[model samples]
Target: MGGPSEEPELWAFLESLHCGDILSGTVTAIERFGVFVALDDGPAHSVFPGVGFISFAELSSRRFEAASDVVQVGRRVSCEFLQFDTWNLEARLSLKATQPDPFQLFVDAIAVGEKLPGQVTKLIPFGAFVQVADGVEGLVHLRELAWTPVETPSDVVQVGDEITVVVTEIDRERHRVALSRRQGSSAV
Candidate 1:
């Protein structure tokens, strides 16, 4: 009764959600606390779930003193739904939740002498996030994304760009896999 006509109907949609999945949602309400959006569902009647959520910390970039400065009611917004609280009936979301730092899977599966194709999920001044396997990603730092100096990772790669990468270092405890684009380029 709370979710959809059939509970199973929503499983596919919910299954799509990873802990740090970042998706685009539409703004429905803008309050002093944060912004809320309606997340579009699949072919079914497009459930109008609360989607957009911007916390106080996310306003650091714009110095958003108030919610009004940050968002306008009924505007389309892109943010990450970090998690959904079933008991509370609230979605814990954030713009940064898309990546939510790095996970240990990459470091665990990677070996020093292996190669993996990395799809760039993000390009930043410092480094880039590459999806090696579903739910697992590796990081290609600015110095490793290219053979030459790159002031910005975007210059060498962009979000969704596919590149070859080599597993250079793996810190299993920290769960971070250091990747190198230059090292794997020749193999590709």
Candidate 2:
């Protein structure tokens, strides 16, 4: 008689995984959508190199243009297991979940009306998104972009422009920080 197949053993190991468990792995591949990791203590994935995968947004607390900016192939990473992707047979992992949120730290250190140096990260018809701190971004509404009425965000600021902004409001529950460049100048 033949022994039990490895499939049952793999299933047993996968069944043992739970959300929030920390897993160590080596990054085996990086795609535009996410990174694939080879878990050190889990059954090897049949279709992928590793059993752990981190999506782009879960890769870092800070904004990065590419996954390679946060992790490289062969890099060892510690990630929190978010869920088991049954379809893919991979563990959905979060790299940022293991790190402290920079936005929360920024909120704890500052208050409304505080002026901070920020760089414009994105400009939209309604407003501009400013990076006030690492991974911390605030929105400067159209009306707040300048003292005078502006037609568009680009009139006051463009992507990569460095400017001063004042914290107009903070919604801790939502982790949203409203900022104003016009108010910043007045506060100075």
- How many clashes show up per model? 2, 0
Candidate lDDT scores, in order, read 0.65, 0.88
lDDT (Cα, tens digit) per residue for candidate 2, span 21-118: 99999999998779999999967877677878899989997888889989999999999999867666678999999999998999999999899999
TM-score of each: 0.44, 0.91
Candidate 2: residue pairs that collide:
none
TM-score of 1: 0.44
RMSD of 1: 12.3
lDDT of 1 at 93: 65
Candidate 2 lDDT for residue 166: 92
Top-TM-score structure, candidate number: 2
Off by over 4 Å in 2: 1-6
